[model samples]
Target: MRISFSKREHDLLERIRSGDEKAMERIYNEYRNEFIGWGVENHSISEQDALDHYQDTITIFFEKVMNGTLQEIESSVKTYLFGIGKNRILQQFQKENTRLRHEEGVHEHYRFLAEKELNDIYTSAIEKTAGMFSLLGEKCKEILKLFYFDKKSMTEIASVMNFKSEGVARTSKKRCLEKIREEMTKERNGG
Candidate 1:
């Protein structure tokens, strides 16, 4: 049995889309207990672990909604949140072999939503990396994007970037990546 969002859910989803903080709080409050309960009860995950997973799920949920990956819900927002929670719990179960009980086709409905989320993750990753890479010099950006984003061969990159040979292109790309890494480290360390 499918469950679509009610009118109130539609309004809340719209507010979330509009970046309303109270809307976010409302959704967080609505699902906090139920999601944590499932993780703690079914998987025996610690409360802290459950809280961490819930936070990550919320991030992914916001990413899906804000980035336009989620549209025209086939189920209630509550159901969708549970589906994300279930996936997170399963990841833990795989490692520790924690308590997991399931019946046939139980998770089928959530598959579409989860798969849609996976598809968005790649694009979102690219956008995120692209943003960070933009902080580099233009030459570094071009070289790195050519090698990583465009997937151009070293030989091709050498020819395009006017490097003497594939060896030179490879060295240049390495140095460019190192510079980006150093910048990222400094940023993370609050340099």
Candidate 2:
């Protein structure tokens, strides 16, 4: 059964949904510090990580409200913020688990299972990364997929991506790698 919200909490959520900056500020001010403390004490997240998670939770909450998915303020705003923070912390743990599993070699049986799981995770991550490339208005996704996934050389990718020269393609590929690294860091840091 869903918990019931206080009248004031419901009103605050409504104001927040309506894009009231004051209401948003009130909610953030009410919960940010306690959520950060909880993240650190319970989840072992670093101070910076806690801060980032708190901000992300607030952002997600606002997005949910705006998207009309946050239909009922069935709990205290503090409870909702804590719930978001908990989920974000757990997501970080899952990503770390996936990374660690990849780093540590496993037995054949485990390896097969890990490979399958990793492929599923990697495919989803790459699709999201590809979407970002689409937003950049460049052929970065195709070039990167061919170079990395297809294991093609710069010259080959240049031919495919229609770069003027292999040198230009190499430079572009290097820049793309840097961008991917940045994206990976963002993902790791729960951004």
| Residues 1-191, model 1: lDDT tens digits | 75668999888877876568899988988899888888899989888888888887887787666545676678988788888878878866334422123211323544653455664643344444566776778888888767764567999999998999999999988898677566556755789
Candidates' lDDT values, in order?
0.74, 0.75
Candidate 1: give the clashing pairs: none
* Winning model by lDDT: 2
TM-score of 2: 0.48
Model 1 stretches astray by more than 4 angstroms = 93-191
Candidate 1 — worst ten consecutive residues by lDDT sum?
A: 97-106
Q: List all candidate RMSDs to the true structure.
A: 13.4, 13.4
Which candidate number has the best TM-score?
Answer: 1
Per-candidate TM-score against the hidden true structure: 0.50, 0.48
